[model samples]
Target chain A: MVITPQRNIVSRTWGTSVGKKSVIAVTGIVFLLYVIAHMIGNLKVFFGIETFDAYSQHLREIGEAIFGYEGVLWGIRAVLVGSVVLHMWAAFSLWYQAKKARPIGYQHRQRWEGSYAARTMRWGGVIIALFVIWHILDLTTGTVNPLGGDESAYLKLVASFDRWYVALFYILAVVALGLHIRHGLWSAIQTFGANSALKQNALKTFAFVVAAVITIGFAIVPLSVMTGLVR
Target chain B: MKLTLRIWRQASPEAKGKMQKYTLDDVEPDMSFLEMLDVLNEKLVLDDKDPVSFDHDCREGICGSCGMVINGNAHGPQKFTTTCQLHMRHFNDGDTIDIEPWRAKAFPVVKDLVVDRSAFDEIIKSGGYISVNTGSAPEAHAIPVDKVSADDAFDAATCIGCGACVAACPNGSSMLFTAAKVTHLGLLPQGQPERATRAINMLATQDELDFGGCTNVGACHEVCPKGIPLASIAQLNHDVLGATLTGARSD
Candidate 1:
């Protein structure tokens, strides 16, 4: 209440391109945490359907001793939803600003820098967003899931991926997620944790490794189901 | 060496421009890229034709007065080399080269190869000048700076306000140029008092000028003549984040 003047300044700061990027960077960390935990949880299916089902049920029951049923899961969902909204808002604003900055085209333009991952970040983000909606519907809500309502997360994953096309689509989206993380994670570091130039190489390598590990971690589940390994 | 040059020719700031082809017969490998242009200009002037105009002052690279896109890369094809310092030796005989101006909304083409880069100056003005004890130089060792910070400060200070970074960026963002100035001063003790405001105001001015937002593409650093690293831009982001969360304001 006393900081209304400061609030105006903070809001105005977010209105700037630099401040908008800050929002993207912070929200990016949120997604990173969520996906990593989700990937690790997905690994429980390897121990068989019963173990995977227990893990899925356990996620909702986390911190229930203090906060009551599904409290922690709801809190996580709220933060994740908030993060996705802010991330897209900032990303779109920056995208528009970037487009408007160069109305005139160079007759002799050439690709001089950036990784393949960096260049495809915008498109990859879009792919991942679409996949997230499909993913939530299939597994979380079980609405369009082949196993349909009340199925556990493991059975939904198995039923969906049993079809070759679903497995293929899931793999495609996971690859896109990997590419997005390969560049986005390092970029987020540059925004929030930038300290010195000496650590750049190490940081970049770390980003790439994390991205690759997470992609493989998520992809294996669908691959196992498609190949009848998890059936 | 002989070469074919496709150069953009614009008469004025508001005029439409087109690429005109020219040939240079006696271009020596030892000659600087700008000197080769000089030879071409000499023949054009003698022929009563309008010569190709480009910006250059110090034939040496440090002045930052000269810049042009040669075959798409800002400051020519070489890494860490300014256009004036780029020599003809790198090219093959009878090679074709394309020359153009720094293209960006903030840095509009002033003529053939010169873009008005006053937007950079506006960003600098927002940073404001650092106040120092000016009556006499303070004791030599009075303000001790760590080796790493001092080295980085010097690295950031080396940005010559050249628009090469802006020209090279895919989005035409001036983040590198603005970051250079911000880090150059912010790293020093003299720059402490205004640090918060400097970060906020400079970025605000940058947005006001309609320059693009940096996407961390690393194109600017790739073509930077000074080799101003991407770390500077990261530092700029860091400062702005700190400023925003702490409720810092220019006023």
Candidate 2:
């Protein structure tokens, strides 16, 4: 790529917010879709340990085991990773600039009475990131104890959720994820140009419900395990 | 009504900005937002303080000059009014209102609530105008334009370039503003000759400008005083992608 001084200087300068926001919105949509797909894949855990592990193994053992090629799933992962990077970079850059614009606080009673969703977006994101890190470690690494009971990979999941606090933390994280996703999803659609009042309201409501379902669905398993509803 | 105002104060572009609070007692609810600011400035001048600076031109809604993020929303709480047209009646007595410039990388603070939006001008300069040879003005009736197409184009053309869309957007994307202009010209019969080229140039320029990519957030259309449709953005994306695919093969 040709790099003129003006182009290089302009690139370093803070670009327009509208432009950045659009990128954020589009990348956000891609990330959300990936999360939803991931959540659905995890739903395979509900059936039984054999079924859950088999499902996961099937994902890895695709093509050679069944279809004779692992093409589509790898492609999907590649797209998901690309979208995640773009989404994270855009979000981080926008946040940094917003912070840069203000150096000091005003002596007014700050009130964000009307916009709870927008205000919590950043925090929600943090909570989700932490949760993802923990989740990956718990499921993939075996570094954390699933609980005090079984050390077996499958048994760890069931055993770990037995603790009320740990299970509750998952539940809360899921709730935050729902709230994050609800606001994020609807906001992305709006950013992309779906601006009718009726449509906006409808999508906003739909996002709220979808996020709620995904969050609750994932959270329920841990709670069920803690209560001995699922052993 | 007595209103407490928290306005951003910055000495210069490099100086760190802060929100300075002041009280305006007996503020008339009927006064426009700018008029209320004027009252505050008069008081500041009396105290030997420099008057607060903000952008304003043709206080009517038509001019795109006046814009500020008031209490988290662009152009304040009122639905369609620009900051200049926003009235104090919408606020409560003794209510402290927070005000700040449109926060974005592309828009730097020149002064309190006055941002340098020249980035927008640069984007426009890149390919926003139709290049035509100098000649007599074309007859209005010579080129027949469908009323609906003309109206849609006019509606898209109503973008005031206030940069509110960027401020409201989560990622600070300018897709809506740039897309609106692209669609406005691309919709017309006269614009067809340069439509493909215009899309490629404008889209590429928009990316080159370091503006964030379109995330499809509808905040731009929501806060737009001109009510620019978000559909135009989708159309612009489609056209840009299509143009890119067909325009040429340049490695």
Model 2: CA > 4 A from native: A1-62, A65-130, A146-154, A176-209, B11-23, B42-49, B133-151, B168-172, B196-200, B203-219, B243-251
lDDT of 2 by residue, B124-232 (tens): 7766778778889888899899997898789889998999887776656677888889889988987877676565566566565555555454677778888888778
For model 1, the superposed segments whose C-alpha errors exceed 4 Å read: A1-9, A63-69
Score every model by TM-score.
Answer: 0.94, 0.74
Candidate 1 C-alpha lDDT tens digits along A142-226: 8889888797777788888988898899999999999999999999888773745788889889999999999999999889887
> Candidate 1 docking: what grade?
acceptable
Each prediction's Cα lDDT score? 0.86, 0.72
The TM-score of predicted model 1 comes to: 0.94
Q: What does DockQ come to for candidate 1?
A: 0.49
User: Which number leads on TM-score?
Assistant: 1
C-alpha lDDT of residue A164 in model 1:
88
Cα displacement (angstroms), candidate 2, residue B189, comes to 3.3
